[model samples]
Target: MISIPDEIGNLSGLITVELHLNDIEGSIPTRMKELMNLQQLDLRGNRLDCSISDEFCQLKNLGWLALSNNKIHGLVPTCLGNLTSLRYLDLGSNNLTSRLPSALWSLKDILELDLSSNALIGSIPPQIQNLRAITKLNPSRNKIAGNIPDRIGSLLSLQFLDLSLNFITGMIPKSMETLIDLRYLNVSHNKLRGEIPDGGLSKNLTGQSFMMNDALCGRNPSLQIQPCVNQISQQRSNLVEMHIAYTPRLNIMIDVTSGLEYLHEGYSSPIVHCDLKPSNVLLDEDMVAHVSDFGISKLLDSGQSKTKTKTLATIGYIAPEYDQKELCLQKEMFIALGLR
Candidate 1:
């Protein structure tokens, strides 16, 4: 391995420096700022154990920068936001730490940004909504937490996004339901809960793209998730609210029962939703009530024939046999829906 010679920065009129795939080591010389006309700097696939130079931001004419597959560590310099002419950036496969600087979102001219495979922590700032010109963003394989920003859907030009293998929490933002241009998304292996939003860009992704988050539920059979309560509430809110006669109410009640039938008998294994109530019953776009809320549910395989321990259920809806033994699915659903 060889260390970059400091005197090499004397090339004042250098336009591009491609030293990738070498075994070069040591810090990137600070005098590199003298390359005022440099447009691209590719030092990837090296053993450089240097801090990413903050001085590189002074290369005002730079458009593409790739420093991946190095031993570079420490925080990404916020000064990078000053590279207004930059269009593509890749800093992946490094040992960089600390929260991503919100200032990086100010790169309005950037098209693709890759910061994956680092030790980055903290929440993705809402400032990302301002990157209206960006198309692809990959920040996977980090320690990021907090809810996904609601404004992510506002990036009309975004085509691909990957935030997998992080500590992200809370529901997938409802704002994401409007991402008309999103063709690819991966949010798996996080703490995200609630139902994956139906329709729009989300509908295009398969269950594999959203796996490992056990708290998540969805209406799509392909995802194998229990429908969420929030989806039901949204359906109810969209209704006309006219008073329905007894006959129409009966039909809604039957639909609710049929939903339970699928859970108890339609599947090879039976699923018992211990806490069934009106709030747990969600309606789809067609006003069909679907049983939901599997927070306290139990699964019964035909082979094991096991039952779950009793916890709490809604006051009026609790079954008599529930306190004595495992809940009986047929009786539990009837009592919960009958009173509603």
Candidate 2:
């Protein structure tokens, strides 16, 4: 592991510093900004720590700067927006902190920007609408919060987007449904709520891509998501042939039975879905029922038939045998559902 010597800055005319894939330690030399002719600075896969200095923004001639896979920390210098010639910039997989600077939207020549796996906070600035040249933007696995900017759809050139594992909230911008060129998208594991947008690239996305969010609902049967109320209401409004819907009603019943079977005998250990009400049954476009809201479900491990717990079923759905304490069982859940 070599410490980059400060004396190298005296060379003055250096154009590129490709010291990546090394065990280089310690902070970058402050005087390295003297490399007036430097165009690319690739120091990826290194052990370099310390904050990125403002001097880096002084490299007016720089075009490609890749400093990923390092321990580099602190706020990204706002002056980075001044690098008009920059085309590609990657600072991913680092320990960098602070909110992203809105000034970044000014980099009209930038084609790709990756700042994922950092400790960045705050919402994506609305000024992102100006990044017309950006084709790929990854800010996933960060601490970013608030709604995804509604103007994100303005980036017509966007192809790849990953905003997973953040604290982002609110509905996905409706404008995103207009991104015809988008090929990949992942916004899972966040606090996003509302119906998943349909049409365009959204139809191509699957259940796995939007899992772990408790409130997200969609219409795609392949995605196995429960249809949102708006979608269900729309379907009902358009159901001119109500007499032909008997088959769909039977399908819902069969799906509920299948769900109960899974809970009773599917896993390595048996589970009892204690609460089985109409409200707890989610439906897809095909009217297939999906068991949901397992807030009070119980597990019966090996040698254990049933464990007693406080009664938690909805009124009128509760079995007479269930008193102050109840032993949640599959048969009881079925009986409760049958009564309703």
Candidate 3:
């Protein structure tokens, strides 16, 4: 602060400073730049404003910076790229805008970057791909738009990514599959379309990633988008087409016998696949998929059958009453939710 810069900067051996939760006023001190040994600084929740001094970037030893919830505005000083040892950066809830300094990616050791709730706009820079150590990134609630660079997946260490509440559009880059370490991802409420990687983060994420977009679908369980979601979403032909119609069709081999008429012949049941399982279904001589084992099938089942013919799936796939199957001895106890 301008009031105590002489006292605060006098401690040449000091490694950290916590001036948050105070009524500090005036521009940050030019003398505070004298803390050459400082490794951490937290000036959050202050009334600080004005473009940060270019000299602030002189603190090359600084490893962490948290100046969030301030009144700072104007482009983030490109000099920040000089903080090569930084591991954390949070500039959230500020008025900052303009093309983010490409130097930002210079912090190779950075683990978490939070620039959400700012006025930042423009395409997410391709230079961001250089940050290979990022573990969590929150760029939500901004004006960012344009195609998310295909290189975004290069952050193999990313554990959580939140790009929601923005104007971003275009198909999600397939390179995103490179993030095998991702546990939680939210690209919802954006314009990202296309299926996520089958072997990478896409496998661990869920339908939550592709929701709200007119044309986005993926293998992520949280984004349970149907084939139609991709059929209509043809933004980038360069990436692999992601549509439901291309669902894998398994090839089957079977043999037919005489005296056994076609089971579907004039059948009033219409033979909808309420429960499709290997035990309840089989392939005919014509190699056509069929449902046969109906030991625990439901009559009211039409669409996605919650209670299947058998206890074939795991917890998430089981019907609520299916757990009560322990009390009922019959093949069918309660009806599953579906069409009749």
> Clashes in each model (backbone N, CA, C under 3 Å)?
1, 0, 8
The lDDT leader among the candidates is: 2
lDDT of each: 0.83, 0.85, 0.67
TM-score of each: 0.66, 0.69, 0.63
lDDT of 2 by residue, 1-340 (tens): 5889999789788888899999899999999899999998999999999788999999999999999999999999889999998989999999988788877889987999999999998889888987888999999999999998999989899999999999999988889988999988998899988877777857777777777778888877777777898889888877834634555666777888888898787887888877777788876665667999887788888666677778567556665546555577667777766734
Candidate 3: the clashing residue pairs are: 206-222, 206-223, 207-221, 207-222, 207-223, 208-222, 227-244, 280-293
Which TM-score value belongs to model 3? 0.63
Residues 1-340 of candidate 3 have per-residue lDDT tens digits of 4433556667878898988868566667777788899999998888887567787788889888998888878888888888888898998888898676677877777999998888888778787888889999888888888988888878889898999889889877878777778888888788776655566666655676667887765544455775545444554442333422242443321221110123222243323223333343454544454546444333332332233344433334554544544322122211331211
TM-score of 2: 0.69
Query: Lowest-lDDT window of 10 residues in candidate 1?
Result: 238-247
> After TM-score superposition, what is the CA distance of residue 114 in candidate 2 from its true location, in Å?
1.1
Q: Return the top candidate by TM-score.
A: 2
lDDT for 243 in candidate 2 is 35
